[model samples]
Target: MPTIRPSGPADAAVLADIWRASVRATHDFLSEAHFTEIEALVADQYLPQAPLWVIEVDGSPAGFMGLSGAHVDALFIDPRRRAQGLGRSMIAHAARLEGKLTVDVNEQNPQAVGFYERMGFRQTGRSPQDDAGRPYPLLHMRQE
Candidate 1:
């Protein structure tokens, strides 16, 4: 059985490892440089602000997710665990939150764009680069 629960400070390192592995799993499609930066950013900046959840399958951490307001900050399932509905379960959990849920995916990540759409999120708008000048195409969506 798989269980979903809140992440604590103790889980940070494991969450970082998951983030790294998830990025590497999609390396064929994403820019290597971008993935490198993202891994470090997740370890340093994003993880602290977002609320994380650890997915344990039979008492072992199989994946993790991070939620921030209406946006899904991070959601990753080990490559070996893909297609088992963990991602769907995590997204569904986020959708059940108090407000609209959104996620900003790179325009280049078509798989994610389609996945979010399949999850019932609609394209609402776009956004410019942040203070760091990193161009992140925004996907504003909400659960129906």
Candidate 2:
């Protein structure tokens, strides 16, 4: 079973690791160079500003999610733990905090889209590019 808890400074590195591992596994359309760039930004930039939660399995950090207002800013699970309900657990926890939740999923990543859809998020809109102006398209989803 997995447990969720508020994240602190000490969990930053673990969260970054999980983010990198998860992205590498599922974001096949992204280049290696992009991963390196994202890793740096997430570790030194994003994580410090977001209110994140860490998900642990057997006392080890397996994943994390960052919430900003009513939106899920980020969610990543260790590649090794994919499909084992860790991501679902993280989303469920986030929904508890923000009853109606929203998230932007990479359009290139069908698995993420499917997961969010299965979790009751409906496509509300889309963006031609990601927030960073990358070529990656984003599917805006909402669950109410």
Candidate 3:
């Protein structure tokens, strides 16, 4: 059975691993240095502070999403689990909680942009640099 549950301390390591694998597969725009830096933060800083939810298939972790209020701070699924509807499930879960969810998608990741569009999100704005002032651009989106 597939289930969504709140993450506990013990799930941190597995979630971090999934985050790394998911980023490696989808975020090709991240430079090596930036990837290393962000990975460190995700494991040490971001994961610890974020309100996280894990999705499991057959009681095994397949993906996670980090949320802060209505904002989707992060969403990642194990690469092996791609195209399995986990991401869409997470987004739908978020929508029910937030009423109208918001997220920032990397402009360079057309796959993600299209996925959000298909999920009923529309671009509301854009930033030339990501939150950390990295060169990577971000497209701000809100559910419409």
lDDT of every model, 2 decimals: 0.73, 0.89, 0.91
CA-only RMSD, every prediction: 2.5, 1.2, 0.9
Question: Tens digit of lDDT per residue, candidate 2, span 1-144?
Answer: 789998888888888888878887889999778778888899998887677889899999998888987899888889898889988888888888878899999999999999999999999999999999988999999985
Ranking by TM-score: 3, 2, 1
Clashing residue pairs in candidate 2 (N, C-alpha, C atoms within 3 angstroms): none
**Candidate 2 lDDT score relative to the true structure:** 0.89
Residue-wise lDDT of candidate 3 within 21-122, one digit each (tens)? 999999999999999999999999877667798999989999999888889888899999989999999999988888889999999989889988999899
Q: Encode model 1's per-residue lDDT on 12-123: one tens digit a residue.
A: 7777887777767754554678667767788887766567888988887778887767778677888778778888888877777746577766555666677788887887
| Residue-pair clashes per candidate | 1, 0, 0
- Candidate with top TM-score is 3
Evaluated at residue 51, the lDDT of candidate 1 is: 72
Candidate 2 residues lying further than 4 Å off, grouped into runs, are: none
